[model samples]
Target: MVPPLALDIDGTLTTPEGTIAPRAFPLLAAWEAPVVLATGKAFPYPVALCQFVGIPERAIAENGGVALVDGHLDYAGDPERVDAAVEAFEERGGDLGWDGVDTVNRWRETEVAVSPTADEELLRDIAAEFDLAVVDSGYAYHLKSPDASKGAALTDVAETLGHDPGEFVAVGDSENDASTFAVAGESYAVANADETAKRAADRVLDRGYVDGTLDALRAIRDRAKNGE
Candidate 1:
């Protein structure tokens, strides 16, 4: 069996404008492996997509702040800690909040997701005030748990699912996913990924979005077939 896949949804699964690629749904539907949709998306989408793909039982969301399985939600940080970080940012008149990100992304229980338009340095400074952590999702700056992260969660899930970390393929195109890349046995970055993200990958695809993903997957499958 192929190593389980841990994928980021934004630029890797969707187009640059954040629309789901035309090939995405079908590609996922036909997959026959233990794959986790790892992303910064809050909810519903994670759960909803999981349902659409026959894995409605588990998801990784909120940049690693949340883990959902069998409709159960697990959080890495306490609400009080998250709220204090939020409050610290709010002390600056809450101007660091992002409005351009997906509108429904408001229910950030474990972290506050801010748009790129927000002051990155200021946001980091605010999190520092309360000993919180701020990480970039390529598109947003998230104030989140000091320890729980996309990479850590991916590794955790892979282990729980009985796969060695070396048997996991982590894919993404953002900063939040950098951690996932570091922990997984193989890492792939789409053509549209940022420089930092691309640098972290073991392989760089030629295409973007799901097309690029499918292309790379085919090569991996071929390699296994050839005993290479």
Candidate 2:
């Protein structure tokens, strides 16, 4: 059985400053399962990450808005939900824009990039008012569609690969990752995860940031291999 692994970037895979740890490369090189980077960063960021991680083509980009498979732009899902969400944002006095959506490698999942300087606080307030889940990535904010989520994106990839959802593990460190953790067979959070994320996780690592995240991945991989 192949186990799929979904990893979050930023505070999870890299430090808060966006540097991938040196220890990570070797471990990633040895990974046997399909590894997906699930993040809120845009194509350029994930494209850079794919170069660094040596998986330059196989990745999900734009938070499920785009899907890249085997170095190609395989799928770009409907933007109806995101479009509606954007309209709602505008109605709330928030201006959000996307240059274009594509499945570019850089991070863990398919993602759509909102303007880096988008007004996050206002977006969050609007999201809350509309009962939507707002993901704040410091540099940008995302309003997830009811059907578009990291978990849903991972499920789509797993299905395409003929893997069971129950065989996959997910690890993340923020509110955006809440759904990702919730849908995984086993889920984890770094020690520094927010209250909501920590509460949603099945386990919490002893460390935080890249160190904690790498350790958590190793633990999950080992546990699966050993049937622990």
TM-scores of the candidates in the order shown: 0.89, 0.75
Candidate 2, residue 26: lDDT: 74
Candidate 1 residues lying further than 4 Å off, grouped into runs, are: 70-73, 96-104
Task: Summing lDDT over every window of 10 consecutive residues in candidate 1, give the lowest-scoring window.
Answer: 96-105
Worst 10 residues of 2 by lDDT: 102-111
Candidate 2, 1-228: lDDT as tens digits: 236677887788877676777678777666887777877766556566767777634455555555554544544444454456567778877766544452322232322345557777777666566555556554456565445666776777777767876677887887778878877898888887887778989998899888887887777668768886
Tens-place lDDT digits, model 1, residues 18-106 = 88775667656655677788888885677777776665456788888888754456678655776776677677766655457546356
